[model samples]
Target chain A: MKDKFGLQRIRLSVQILYTILTNGYVYGYMQGKIYKGGLKYACVPGLNCYSCPGATFSCPLGALQSALNQRQIQVPFAVLGFFFLFGSIFGRFVCGWLCPFGLFQDLLHRIPLFQKRKQLPGHRMLKYGKYLVLAGLVLVGSSFLFDGFVKVPAFCKYLCPSGTLMGALPLLSVNEQLRSQVGGLFGWKLGLLLVLVGLSVKVYRPFCQYLCPLGAIYGWFNRFSLVQIHWEQEACISCGACQKACPVDLKPEQISVSTECMKCGKCMTACPVQCLHWRKIEKN
Target chain B: MSFWHKTLDKRPKRGMWFLLFGIGVVCLVIGIYEGQLEDVYRKAVMICLECIGIG
Candidate 1:
């Protein structure tokens, strides 16, 4: 019997590489410094927390929003272009392979804690939540003020579990003064992180599937991205093997560069006939 | 079925993507010239209190 259900060793390696690459400042906690190197000026194409003590680069989503928030700039071409460039190149492959938060969820789901739901209830409706986050919280909220004093970036300020987990949690852990400063806001953020973590054990990256606006941004470019998965329709037997293999339960053929797919290559690995292949561009 | 095929077949040329990439490079350079890189460095060094909703 073939070891068809074997562990994804290469995928794990890729995930770890990105996690360390994005957050490589090992002395940040000991020295109490966020490294302000030239690399810090660039946007990492993943949902890494910008304020993570060890983070060497700013997160693309956070940098984009921060650039927009500056009233002085009419257009933040550097941040915008980085987003466009990465999106057109890799699409949601970053979510599947690079995002530290996605890796965290993948690890959490590996635990034999409980039987997991392969799909969410009202998932079609829930999928829209990330776009809502992109529009209402990240974009509109950052560009405008909620009240006279309050800053409006609702997703990062109120909802981003990655920011809470990687940023606030680490800061609070090392600094006694920071812990003392923690109040209702800290508790609320912690609660959100807990809920998302809990759901991830069952739902295979609930945050990416539902709430990550960064993933949403990348998903938009998945269809036309340089890196794409193409199905050999002629070779397909329609045996539904790939469909069963999908963690998110999407059909293999339709999953090719689709918004919902993370391009994890599960279908390719699972296909009995070996139909799906990753390509830089489709050969027409 | 016909709609899916039509929409799926509509693809931009490889050269067009290369052109877009060049344009994107130009935008990135312009943004850095406009001091966005400096802004990123400034933001990176300091922990964002607002992002964590600490203050």
Candidate 2:
């Protein structure tokens, strides 16, 4: 059996389309569209701007972060429920396919001439970075690191390449008056973007691989998450084709969620043994 | 396939790193010199919040 799952490719394309739509909205493509009840709904599985020129719903992460910052009640409930619903059904498939930010990273990595490098050369614990980031964001945002409520959403403040590439650049281009008022925070974010872009050329997706809090949340449910990639280890001829086919460098035959696996299904497509399959688990 | 196409398609040339690095530095300098960093940050935050449905 050879790799048959083209889901990753399909997902990647869909993500790219979402990014284009979001970016286009920010860049002034569609200006005056009207929504009835003040367009404040959320995308089911991934990040898409509600205020985005063409966005139809709310952004889940933004809502969660704001709730955390404001100390709201139902916000946590909303976040938890959203995670459970998506986690049970799609698992980390959200990271692989649906996330607009993930798409941005994928596109940036496609830029030729950069040698994507591995930030984690130590033990393979690097996969935990996103979880750590999630924790850091919630903890820091709700409570000051050491002092007051000065903690910004650290992920958006420092690490999110999506914010830098999709939202920041286009918005600045259109709002020239806004561009005239730059400072240290902007400098820091630009520096971060530069590093991310450079690293993307060297690594497949440095941000997703290392720092995305959203990816971390989804990845937590990867193993038993309703949408799962299963391997019939018994049908094993360890040809390592799936291993090589993996863009995120996961050895699909061995482990599933090592932070390296984007669940892109490149392994599923490249598996000559055709042992990989996706199935839904019913809660009984 | 033509040699150029083949070359262009395989992966970026090593020197592309230096070129990107140079461009990044220039942008950094220009952005700093022009003193538009805070504006950029605020804009980034507002837009990011909007994109994700926060704003």
Give me the candidate number with maximum lDDT: 1
In candidate 1, which residue ranges exceed 4 Å CA deviation? A1-7, A146-152, B2-6, B11-16
After TM-score superposition, the amount by which residue A80's alpha carbon in candidate 1 deviates from its true location, in angstroms, is 0.8
Question: What is the per-residue lDDT of model 1 for residues A1-284, given as tens digits with 9 covering 90 to 100?
Answer: 23264535677889999899888788875654567778888888898777888888888778777776776546778878887788778888888888999999999988888898766899989999999999988888888855465455567788888888878877777877777777898789889899988998888888999889988988887776788777777898989987787777877556745688888878878888878777776544
Compose the digit string of candidate 2's lDDT tens values, residues A103-165.
Answer: 766777677765555354742677677677778764464344322434355556555556555
Give the CA lDDT, 0 to 100, for residue A66 in model 2.
Answer: 52
Candidate 2, residue A52: lDDT: 43
Best by TM-score: 1
* Native-referenced Cα lDDT, model 1: 0.79
Interface RMSD values for all candidates: 2.0, 19.3
Error of 1 at B44 (Å): 1.3
Badly placed stretches (over 4 Å) of model 2 are A1-9, A20-39, A49-55, A71-75, A112-120, A145-151, A253-260, A282-284, B1-55
